[model samples]
Target: MPGHAGERLILTGPLRLVPGTTEQILSRLADLGRTVSTEDGVTDGLSVLALSVDDVVLCLPTVIMDGRPRRWPSATVDRRIDLTSYAFAEPDLISAYAPELIEHLNVGHADQMRQLARHARPAETEGDIAGVQVSGLDRYGLDLWRVDSAGAEQVRVAFRQPLVEPRSLGRELRRLLDQSANTSE
Candidate 1:
C-alpha cells in the first residue's frame, strides 16, 4: 500500500545493505521516479547499478529462477513470477482506507474471508484450519493471511476486473463473494 513516503516497492532485506542513511536514501529514491526490473538467472546473476538522485550509487542485484522454487544458498524462492511491465500506481482511496477496511473484513466478515481463501486455495482449506484474515488490500485484490495445521501463508485473491471507482468497492466485494460461493457449489 502507498504511504506518506510514496509508492515504494518494499524489498525484504537488512537495512545495513541499503547504503547511506536509510531515511535519506529512501527519501531520495522516492523523489527520483524509477523502476527496477529483474531477469531470471542462476548463480551468475547480473547486478544493475544506477546513480541515485543524490549522486549515490544504488546496487540492485536480482535473482529469479525458472522451474520449481528451491532454497538457494544465498536467497529464498517461494514462487516464480512473470516479467511484466508495471504501470504507474498512484495512491487511491483503497490505499487510504486499507487499514479500516482490513479491520472491518477481519472482524465483521470472517466467513467471507474463508470463502475467498477457499476459492483461491481449495486444497489449503481442508482439515483443521485455524483462521483467515484480511491482511491487506488494493484496487485489484484482497491479500489474505491464512493459518492452518501446516502453517500460515498469504494469498492474493484478485477481483475479476480492476476497480475504477472507490464507491464500487462494496459491489465488487459482493461479486467476489458470490463468485466464490458459486464456484464451490
Candidate 2:
C-alpha cells in the first residue's frame, strides 16, 4: 500500500454484468467515496474508469455496451487478475510498485485456483467397473483418462453447456458416467 499516491491499480479481471447505464457505474463509485473519471476512447480496446486514491491510481475495465446481455460471452474468464497486466501511463511509477503489486495478486490467484482444483474429484469409478481420471479441466469440459483392460486412453469430455465452475464440472462428469452406464446396459 505504501507507494506513490499517483501509482495506478487496474482491475484486469472479468466483471459481472451489472444492469445499468454508464452513469450508474459512476454513481456507484461516488457512493464508495471514489471520484472516478471515464475515458471514452480506446485504451486496450476498452473504455476504462480512472480513480486516484491517496497517491495510487486505479483503472477499471468497462464492458462493451452493444445492447446485448451485459454478461461476457465466455462462461468463465480463464485469465487471472494480474496487476502487471495493467499499463502504467507514468513510466517512473512502473519500477516503484509494480513488482510488489503483481506478486501479491499472483499469490492470491494461485491459492484460489488450488482450492478450486482440490474440490475437483480427479478419479471416479462406475459401479466398480469402469474408471476414469480427470487429467485437466477447462471452461468447455474435462480431460479424462479412461483405464480399462485394454489399457489407459485419454478422452476429452465436453460439456453440452459451458461449465462456470469446478462443482458444475463434477456434476456433468457424473451425468456423463450415468449416461454411459445406461448405454452399456
Best by lDDT: 1
Candidate 2 Cα errors over 4 Å, as ranges: 1-131
TM-score of 1: 0.51
Between which residue pairs do clashes occur in model 1? none
Candidate 2 colliding pairs:
5-55, 5-56, 6-55, 7-57
lDDT of 2 by residue, 1-185 (tens): 22232222533334445545667766776798976543764223223444432232343333447865334343422333334433444334323443453354335444322222222333433223244444555556555555545556666656678665444544765666566556545
lDDT of 1 by residue, 64-181 (tens): 4685343234432223222232223454787777788788889998987887787888866676558898887888998998888889989999988877666667788899889888
How much is the lDDT of residue 56 in candidate 2?
Answer: 25
lDDT score at residue 2, model 1, on the 0-100 scale = 25
Question: Each model's TM-score?
Answer: 0.51, 0.30
Cα-based lDDT for every prediction: 0.64, 0.45
Q: Tell me how candidate 1 scores on lDDT.
A: 0.64
